[model samples]
Target: MRLNSLVKPLLITGFMLAGTAQAAPDAREVLEASPVDDIVAQYPEMMSRGIQDGLKQSGQVPPMVADSIGFLVSNSFRAADIEQRVVANLEAALTPEQLEEVHGWYQTPVAGKIAEAEIAASAPAAWPEIRSRAEDLNKRYQGTAREKLFDRFDAASRATESAVDTTIAVQLGLGTAMAALSRDSVHHEKMRERLESQRPALRGMVGQQVYDGYLFTYRDISNQEMNLYLDFLESEAGRSFTRVVTNSVQQAVIEPVESIGARLAAFGNFGGE
Candidate 1:
């Protein structure tokens, strides 16, 4: 799929709703009250160490949750602006026939089933063993190895965030194209009318799917990576590498792989013609 096409729904709806008069929710409070706390609570290493705030994980003084929330909201808004153009182009290129396919793809039982299956398959069978190994490695390395590995994980996570932002930006561009390609004023009006008519249902469906997909991707990827990481943490050399190299490679190489894959897919479709 084109990058813009993948991002349109995520960026567009958020933008369209930006003008609403409702008071914006507090990002920090929301983050604190969110599943973030639950996840943090469940983190064996961090939780055991009383490091629920991410700052301590990196050996930094934890900032107020409000401050982190502010940063997150600012970043989100800025990213949305950059994504608008991508969405425009995406919408422009979406033929009616293609739109049907997109809708069908999202709605299919196959998509959800496959996603779930992949997630299940990605989970490690022995989380306790993995954790034990990590703990032993941490003891042997005096925590240095574990710290290094975590740094790498953080870097990779940031890179993933960047890719998602870029994808959304491309989608916004596509949306602009779509808006322009729309026929006469009447035709545009009709499209708007139709969108308005379907707004509630479309928003509910899209929002739920996007949120669920995000959670699934996050969990599956994290679990898969953690399994390998724990194994490494248990080994002396693996611990050293995690401390020195894991995060760097994840950020520098692994994260960009998706975007590169997307680019290659586009090129393949064009066939060098």
Candidate 2:
């Protein structure tokens, strides 16, 4: 064998090895590259805020009871646990090729900017601004092309559906807590049936709220970039990513609340009142 021939073969082998080494990222690495983890990391705080707000709106629960329930519910949904569940779901729900594509998209500049907007909107501080501007936003964008785009994006991303799911989950949690306080049994089936019957009305209400939120969050995002985002959301990997993240977060939020009643009941006399 000639020395030149051997050298050429060695070079080709090296290139092949390098290519193989650059394989698709694992679940955690994919998560790190995306904003999913950051968004999910805020779930516990969001859940807590929702519980407090719901209690306040009802204006029925005593402050001490409300506070105790809030503490118990908040402590139950840790960011770590939610993140772990999200990663696991991603690994299970997505194929290797889909995961690779999903990871690649999240690393793009457009994805980064979109993620920044989402994270900002998810923050506790952003709620006031979002609420204050929602009316003006709706008035300005209600019939525009951008609104249409937002509507499409919401449909592709199932934003309204996710909001509805989260709302129902919170309602179930509150019901469990109330039942516990009253020393009554919580029939989850009946509760779910009732909520299901109300789903249409809830969907209409949440859909509008979701639209308003999109207007506020993506106000600065150009239509071109949003179109790019919509493309991703409509893609196979994008769909898988949405399903995995939505399911994981819902499970994390919903599962913890099942025990909220028992936990609250442990407060004994205070829970009774």
Kindly list the per-residue Cα lDDT of model 2 for residues 1-273, writing each as its tens digit: 889999999999999999888887888988888887888878777777778777878875877767777787778888888889888989998998989998899889999999999999988678889989999999998778898897689878889999898888778667766766666665767877888899999999989888878999999999899999999999989998888888888888888876775455555437466
lDDT of 1 by residue, 1-273 (tens): 898996998798777777453433222222232222223223233212222232234332235532342233222222222223223332444443433333333244543443344334223333334344544444544544333444454343333434343333332322222333332123434644555575566555544333333333333334445545344334443233222222332232222323432443344445534
What value of lDDT does candidate 1 attain over all alpha carbons?
0.36
Whole-model lDDT, candidate 2?
Answer: 0.83
Error of 1 at 135 (Å): 12
How does residue 160 of candidate 2 score in lDDT?
Answer: 97
For candidate 1, the TM-score is 0.22
Per-prediction TM-score, please? Answer: 0.22, 0.88
- Model 1 regions more than 4 Å off: 1-56, 65-89, 114-273
